[model samples]
Target: MTPLLNYIVSHTKLPEVSIKNTVELLNEDCTIPFISRYRKERTGNLDEVQIGDIVKFKEQFETLEKRKAAILKALEEQDALTSELKQKIEATQDLTTLEDLYLPFKKSRKTKAETARQNGLEPLAKIIMSQNVNDVESVAYKYVKGEIKSVEDALEGARHIISEWINELTDIRNNIRQQLERFAMISTKVVKAKADDENAQKFRDYFEWEEALSRIPSHRLLAILRAESEGFIKVKIEIDDEKALTKIEDRIMRSNNDCTEQIQIAIQDAYKRLLLPSLSNEALQNAKTKADEAAISVFAKNLKQLLLGSPLGEKRVLAIDPGFRTGCKVVCLDAQGGLLYNETIYPHPPKSDTIGAMKKISSLTEAYQIEAIAIGNGTASRETEAVIRKIHFKNDIQVFVVSEAGASIYSASKIARDEFPNYDVTVRGSVSIGRRLQDPLAELVKIDAKSIGVGQYQHDVDQTKLKKELDVVVESCVNAVGVNLNTASTSLLSYVSGIGPKLAENIVAYRDENGAFTSRNEVKKVPRLGGKAFEQGAAFLRIKEAKNPLDDSAVHPESYAIVEKMAKDLGKHVTDLIGNKDQLQNIDLKKYCTETVGLPTLQDIINELEKPGLDIREQAKVFTFNQNIKTINDLREGQLLPGIVNNITNFGCFVDVGIKESGLIHVSNLSDSFVKDVNEHVSLHQQVIVKVLDVDVPRKRIQLKLHK
Candidate 1:
């Protein structure tokens, strides 16, 4: 435990005391959101990301420790566990180094080295490796036994054993790794049979590509690997063979003699047949792991942004799932996103019921008292939006074109089915569109993060890692913007601190079976919701019109006594102190500070007091696209048009410019200067104006430069 604590502290550069307290909290079954939010003073006010770093390092340490234990046990079983070896294995910090240290002791299958040892040539191999044997042939003649034909045969077998020894030498392997780290090149070539295949055309850029393995961008590397996986290309890692061999020989060779010459042969054979292949693969796997991390990081960031996207709040919304031939499916949702009505209207082409659609929309807006309209940006979305805009409704209603990216997935999901059991998929999809506008976090949590569609090679990256990262991001975002206890769905509640799927279900079930919770204390009455769960999740759950106003704020229930004390000191009621900025500013935070409740927690309490139950997310705004550009063919070079950044990657961002084909804002065209990060320039759902650089109608590609 101490070693693990020290490792996390060293790697994260966090204060040892803070890391120790955090680890204690984690071991006590505390979640990251709980430790970072509720126990700030204990963790030295570490933010979510910082606490996340601690968690990552802790998991890695546990993995390393587990591997070390297994290696020690394996060596013990083989009667090869030396004290020095055990100490070295236990001291290693990473899996790669530990595995390398354990390589020699690993049991092997039948190989040339094993065969030679079985044939009694290991002593001869060692004598030659010592480089002191002047007459190698005389030494080899002694080993001319069963299956040993001649002196050359004996020497060859000895060389084979020497090669295996060279492969096992830790220093030799590490030296080659250092060389490969600096000089390895990854190259890809089109498979001979797949050279002219139409499906291989997508990877034409990588058909004959070579780049420094260390310098390649993660997205590009993922693409190359994907192409290789699909049998479109052959990939290889290479380094200067002469330089690597020379370095190994420099480590092994001592003198110029017959024995030295024989050792040289073994060195070359070991490098080509064993070392290069094994180490090169290790190097590539390392690179791939790094690439996977990078890709997953981008996906997680994009998912966070998409999940925390600005909400339209509790407004009566009319949403449409646009289609041309099938007609647009429209649904009216009440303020809380309850489906009031659903029907289809065809306002374009075949059905062309423009006046009828407009009348129905106007009547629905007035009937449901709709404040906003959400249109899914799918087929015929623009045409439907145009028709809706033509109607002069009794009330002013803002219209939004929402990304239909995961709407279908959500509509067909079991959660959606349970929520709207009587409705078909189209009606459920329209409801999803409207609810997404009302609250992205609540709606998106029900759908899989990957299906949200903001990613770079999401399927190609590590699935477990991507899922873990995305879950963390979702949890962070959900906790960051607190959940409404009375209104939050099971999906939203599930992400709050200690409340997982089963607990979320229990909370919802308790809410339905009994009634909405009136205060924080009532939460404990829910079956199976114990002390720890309440401590971790109570603050993140908000209840409007609660008996205690603090129950609606971010303040934890445990801090109610402190607030009551503060109000008592101020000679006012707790309700009077709530949102009393003048009184809050006058209180000396130092006076309230205790061993457990320090300035950080006190300050947070004061901040929450100022804005009780206020959402951190921005209110959704209406955005409009260029009216002139309906398709890629209508776009012209140098025409500036409004766009929304739908997806962000390391290389660039994709912008939806009111067309079927989204435009590419390449990293170079993002700005006049070098763009290190695409997110620094743009984020998911950011509205920007872009100038069209090129539009390839046949290929359905649009290139745009950021107008800003």
Candidate 2:
């Protein structure tokens, strides 16, 4: 095993793994999820993420091994395999070094050696290299056979053989490749398009430029390459030929002899035809792969920030899926997300009945005591907002423009239909939009996360890798904020530890028939929820208003007896010991410590006991966008505008300004001082007030200062 892989296993306290065993397991069809859950004993309970890292490293190791085997086989076939060559191949850690070692033995297209051999000048060429020639012309004249009819022809054939021998030296080829890759620059020139061609304007930015291969970012490289392929640009990789030739000559030239000139010509041919093209292509491909990885990494980071964005918290909300022709689909949801009512109202042109819509909204607000209004930021959303603003309610109800990026997709989803079989698609969409505002985690699971549109270049990334990564993000979010066992949908519950689709459905089914679980112990009574399942999942599940208050908290059932013992020692009931700061501080915590209760476990217990069933989510603060500012024209310099952060990148943060599009708050404008990363200043879904600093209406680029 490599030191890095061994270190990872040792530091993680995971199972002892041999290099061969890991490679074999990774080569099999077993998935990360399967191995993590079902084969826990084999992997020593390493989670999916750790196992995935192991699998990736294992694949890399195997690829390196395969490359070594290929090099050895090719060399053996050519009868050039020696103990030194075999040792070098076995010791090679990277593909580049292995290829360097195998360069001499690799088969190539028709070469000078075969040509010289066919011309019957092999004996003369051997005599030249043997350096026994007192007179070169006399030796060359001796091999003037049928193919070599003249002294010049015979010398040329001998020179070809000598050139081939010089090119076959592996060390010389390796040196040339290294120097070229380091000093190369790719140049691109755009071809002038036809006068009437529309593509001409699109490719104007990349008309001409030369850049180092290492310096070009992936997005720009891909864009420029695409333009070149479309006939608007010409691109080529160039290296300083004089410098390259000198480096090649320095390595191969030993002394002044007739063979020296032939070797020089051979090195140039090898470099131009074989080595340069191959190495340049490899470097370009490697650069592109690196760029893709960086972009995908950024996308994954953005996705994680978006997925972990704060939920609006549970509230009785009225959601409106705004539309002009089809009318606005409205749904009222109670605090627990149970659908209270549904209706449709048109408040725009063709059926512009504002009064009727206002009456319906007012009645629903009063009936449900709606605390907030979630307006879907889709077509006719502003008109719907105007209608709601005009309605006078008994209590203040704040309206919010919820991002309906995937609400329609979720409505058309099978899971949505399965959840609400009788409801129309529009009604389902409205409910989803409303529930997202109430609790994003519960509603987002029904729709594909990629459709949420919060990341950079999401669609361009590897689909399988993206899906797996996003699934993990979703899982982390769902678990971080504990699921509500009694009210959570099966989709939401499935993300909880040790609970999958079938198990979540069974739990929900058991709840439907047996009523709400009164205690954590009641879970085992449900069918298929065995001891192991409960052991893995029980700590994350919460039972609000259960018989024991500790059951409502994240404290595990096994630790319940520990808390009970502490309570008894303190001469108080468990409930009295919980949240009783003055009395709890007086008791010695060391008495409660056991072999299983380390400092980490003790701290967790103390935190749980201090705030039993404490919901970590803070109540979302109320804010509203200014109604007067509907367009860029309405925005003024230094005017503070309330908005939610839509996305964050390395360069800046994008804020939704309620103008159908978002504005960029460049990294420089994010704070009073320098900002290293956008995530450090703001996160997705964070509400902030920004001051508009500049606007370019033509480009639709609005710059804002987030310094306030």
Candidate 3:
């Protein structure tokens, strides 16, 4: 194992046996789902993320080992593989250092030294490098034969040979590169194009600036680099050559001799011709990579917050994806998120028919017995809600403004199109918006998480890394909220601990062939789902109406006997004792407290038994926007407006005030008193009451005050 991988395993407190078994399984080409399912006892139940980390670490280690072997072999072939050199190669941890050590021995393009050797000038070049010049011009004149015609020509040719030799000295090049890299400043400048040029305005603001490379933020650096590459700007890194030259010269000209001047000239030539371009390019590339890593980390963090946003729980809901001229698309979904009906309504004029729109919504609600309305917070949403509020119904129906950030992307996606072939794009989007309110996790997996736009610099980051991180987030969320065995879609089940696409499909196929799973043991009957697969996955697969109540909770099957023993000792039938709160409260929990059954587990069991099939989501709260308000113009100063916190960033919080656009409660305006972290005060999906502070109609910006 690599030291880095070893360190991670140790620090993460993952069991050594589990890590070893997982690594072996991964090495043998076992997929994460396969290994996690079929090798539960070997892996000690390590989830996909942990297994993935091990796989990545193992691959990196093997790659580094291969590189080390190649470097050693290349050095040996060049007859420069000294004992010290071999040790250095073996001991090096970083790829850069290993490459630096092997650089001089590695083959290069045809150079002056190789050409001079062919022309029989190597002997003279060597004598000059010894720095014991007898007579410089006389020594050069002796080589003035065939290719070396003139005395000046001979000296210049000899100088070229010596210069190539100096360049070959990796130590001298390394010294020069270090000095230049430290003192260099990257400067980017943009020039104005002709007034009529099509792309002039896009780059006008970045006309001139110089920044320390280390201090520049990743986003700004990437922006500047991209602009320069697009021909909108010019960029360069200016290095202090005099200082760099001094460092190089000092190393090469250690002892002052007759050939010191020649050596100095040779060193300077090497820097200008061979070293500067290569070193500068490398440094810039490294900077760009670092910037990308930083940006990707930020994006992953933001995506996590958005994905983990609290769900409103399962309820019958009416969803509306709003529009202006095209009107509003409405969808009605049952409590289980199955679509019941859909239609379009024009609540805003040009095409506005308020009475007809109201009637359509009322008819759908009455027919479906809808409990709530989940309106997409997109274009014309407020106008649509206004129509819904005006119509009175027998049941008290709540209204919620659901974030539709990626709803359009999902609607236009192949999955959505396939799921609802008969429906229009807008209607599909409304169905997605409604399903999100019922279960965010199930609906979100259909769209690319990056397109959801909850994260920062998501587009400008490393796409591969971002996808991996977001996939892990999805897996974690799915496992955290155990999957419903009978009802989960393949997309949802695919994220379960031990289930992949194939296994999920098999489960569905078995269900379709037979019927729903009545107990946890029924999962084993699925094709290719053996004993081990059942062990890893059964605990996380919830059965709402299983014969045994424990199957509905997170407690694994292995622990069922212990719980049954406890119930037997308590002088009650297992079912009666499980949910009997008075009996549970009176039983001394200490009697059940073993090494495995600690206070935490005991308490969890008690809670689970009391609320069998308990979902962690909060009960859906019913809220409605006032019909009197539709736009910023109708929002008066100091009037309290009920809003939902759509996004919380370090700078401020954004609240959706039952409008097409959301208003900002800037960090400074978030409260009557000082506030630091916005997350502490508000979270994603939280409901708040804020007063309108300022409005800019032309800019469509609304400032809000949370103090009220």
Best by TM-score: 1
- Please, what is the TM-score per model? 0.97, 0.79, 0.81
Error of 3 at 433 (Å): 0.9
Candidate 2 Cα errors over 4 Å, as ranges:
1-92, 95-204, 207-209, 217-238, 255-266, 272-274, 422-424, 500-502, 509-515, 521-533, 583-589, 592-596, 635-640, 671-673
lDDT of 3 by residue, 1-708 (tens): 656457447545688778877777766655565455335657877776677677666666667779999988877787888999998888876677778777666645576666666667777777778888857778877887887777677656667777766666667666756665576688876645642355655555555778877667676777777677667778787688888788777776766766777778777777787677767777777788788776665555555566665567767999998888988888899888888888878878788788888888888888999988998878777777667778998898888777798998998988787678888788889999998888887788888888887654567666787787778777766766788898888778887876777898899889988998999988998999877567667777999868888888877787687679778888777788767788877767788766544565566567667776666656556566656778767877777888887766556778877876689998788776788666667776677888888887866889998855
RMSD of each: 1.6, 5.8, 5.1
User: What is residue 197's positional error in candidate 2, in angstroms?
Assistant: 6.9
Evaluated against the true structure, the overall lDDT of model 2 is 0.75
Q: Across residues 520-571, which tens digit of lDDT does each residue of candidate 1 receive? A: 7888988899999999999999898988899999998889999999999989
Residue ranges of candidate 1 with Cα displaced over 4 Å:
147-152
Q: Model 2, range 271-346, lDDT digits (tens) per residue? A: 7766677667777777766766665665666666655545677689999999999999999999988899999898
Off by over 4 Å in 3: 1-62, 70-83, 108-128, 134-184, 194-205, 238-240, 256-258, 269-281, 577-614, 619-682, 686-708
Candidate scoring better on lDDT of 1 and 3: 1
lDDT of 3: 0.75
